[model samples]
Target: MSPPSATLPAIAVAGLAKTYGDVQAVAGIDFTVSQGSVTALLGGNGAGKTTTIAMLLGLLKPSAGSITVLGTDMLHDRHAVLPRLNFSSPYVDLPHRLTVRQNLRVFAQLYDVPGPKQRIAQLAQKLDFTTLLDRPAGALSAGQKTRVALAKALINRPELLLLDEPTASLDPDTADWVRGLLEDYRAERGATILLASHNMAEVERLCDQVLMMKQGRIVDRGTPTELIERYGRDNLEEVFLDIARGRGKAAQPAQAETAA
Candidate 1:
């Protein structure tokens, strides 16, 4: 794949907002993610990270703002661009009774991937799930399921990948392996990835930038190192702790930098 160029934004959001009858789930926010970048969306529960992702995927309508992916308006013309994007998370599941290969075949057909069997074979090998291909999906362990979900996500070779808690239930070693796979895929495809995760080390290791949210709004954004330095913390978890506890009063660190 060619190197990503910045002539056009891969993702752009302006005045993005979403509200429910009496509750605000995502307040108006704006940000941009460059092509071939891995950006992290982070926050404590109820922070609106998932809601924001849902909006981008056309799963939720924005009550107020606008979102554009690959120059296509997500709110109004997602169909034109949907095929270029894909998502994965442990919370999502395949058919319980289907064998892993069968589940993948169904999804491959959904995406209309050419050579479905070959594609599945490629993914199974790359993800190290070849041994589990004929096993019932429901019989797999949490870590195995995570790998299957990842293989499904990549079957389309998406230009834009969204991962929400991709490694939530994984052991540390398994999580690291998953992260490595993601990195390899991104490097090979020059894909744009947006990840919402609580794994501080993973984010610091893989993401080029991080956006921190709280109560439906983006409160801070920067490189992991930048946030750690600004918060005078040893690592992202400490910085996250400060923000979660309301100790980081200046959540918008774009205006100024303070020692950790």
Candidate 2:
């Protein structure tokens, strides 16, 4: 892989907004994700986390603002950069009738991944899903499906990976194992990861930076330690509750630095 740009963020959003009729889904938020770092996007339901990610993926057009992904304008040039990134979400399911291997092969082809068969084999072995590769997707349990989804996300070795509730439906042991895979993937490939998860422990363990959202805007952002100290919390879960419930106001430091 080429050296990452010193100046450009892997993802840069300025004044990003999305609206549905009279309701604002995302209210002109601005943030940057550094290359080769793991960042978490935390928010309660209806906080616009999903909307923001959709806009980033060009699945939904922004009402107002700009999105530059990997130095390409996502609004006008999304196709050029789409292949460089991949996303995984439990909400998005693979074709039910397709076998696990078939699904992976299809995605690998879409991403133009070289050596698709070898790549699929490697992922199946690493994720410990080799036995399920030939099973129909609809026949797999939730945990098994989650692993398959993750494998599809990694099929192309994307430079930018966006994951939503990556460990949903996973057993504790398997979840930990998957997290290890993610850590290794980032270190070995120098990939940048943005994950949205309700599992605060998972966020704290995997993330280097945290972006907290409320009412469609970024309310605070910092290292996990910084937010914990600022919010006077023992863990990210506590800080999350403090922010989500309006127990604490956005800090001066975050407000000064962030465009909310």
Candidate 3:
């Protein structure tokens, strides 16, 4: 089947490129994320996933090309468009000196969430953060911190959610819970998500489409099942390994192989 059209992507990128001094961080790449769908940007370190996201979020300028989020040009309408998006990354920490509740409150204020108290209460119940509210951010375990970060990301009721390893530090149960929560949020709000993750299983489970990057360029892309079938692999991990190890270019029939 053909990919979606280019009229108005929830997130649209074309000829996107970025360079720092002599190093080309992101070669010209193009992709479109449909509205209300989860799209995974998959790549290993230095694959330009972070650089691409930074440009989309208007945190970094692209050396070339254009990007539009929710039909608003990121470069020209950044001020008006920023409020419609929020980002969460496990590697990025919240304020260590503040308590969990304090951190949430600060962000809630920044987002101007109506009745911040009630919103906090609701998210606390949903995320099981009631007990950890008074604890300093630095004192929480990795999993706990991840939950708080996620809550902060959602406080804005953003149209576009950018998640970098949302489930990175959580145990299996908590991670599963977080995934379910994301599904529920998407269902209720029709939100679009751009996720970058190393967890291929999570990507397969959550993403409607996937963009695979290599050395700052998108070398391949498809749904998880499409990629798995195309690579003659049992799962996305194998596909990722093959690509990472320089075997991705080898021609193979698009058929599922027995699980290894």
In terms of TM-score, the best-performing candidate is: 2
Instruction: Tell me which residue pairs clash in candidate 2.
Output: none
Range of the 10 consecutive residues with the lowest summed lDDT in candidate 2:
251-260
Residue 141 alpha-carbon offset, candidate 3, angstroms: 1.0
Task: State the weakest 10-residue window (summed lDDT) of model 1.
Answer: 251-260
Per-prediction TM-score to the true structure, in the order listed: 0.93, 0.95, 0.91
Off by over 4 Å in 1: 1-5, 248-260
Candidate with more favorable, higher TM-score: 1 or 2: 2
Worst 10 residues of 3 by lDDT: 251-260
Q: How big is the positional error of residue 37 in model 3, measured in Å on the Cα after superposition?
A: 0.5
Computed on alpha carbons, the lDDT of every model, listed in order, comes to 0.88, 0.90, 0.86
Please write out the lDDT profile of model 1 over residues 145-250, one tens digit for every residue.
9889999999999999999998888999989998999999999999999999999999999999999888888878899999888778899999888888777645
Which residue pairs collide in model 1, if any?
A: 231-260, 232-260
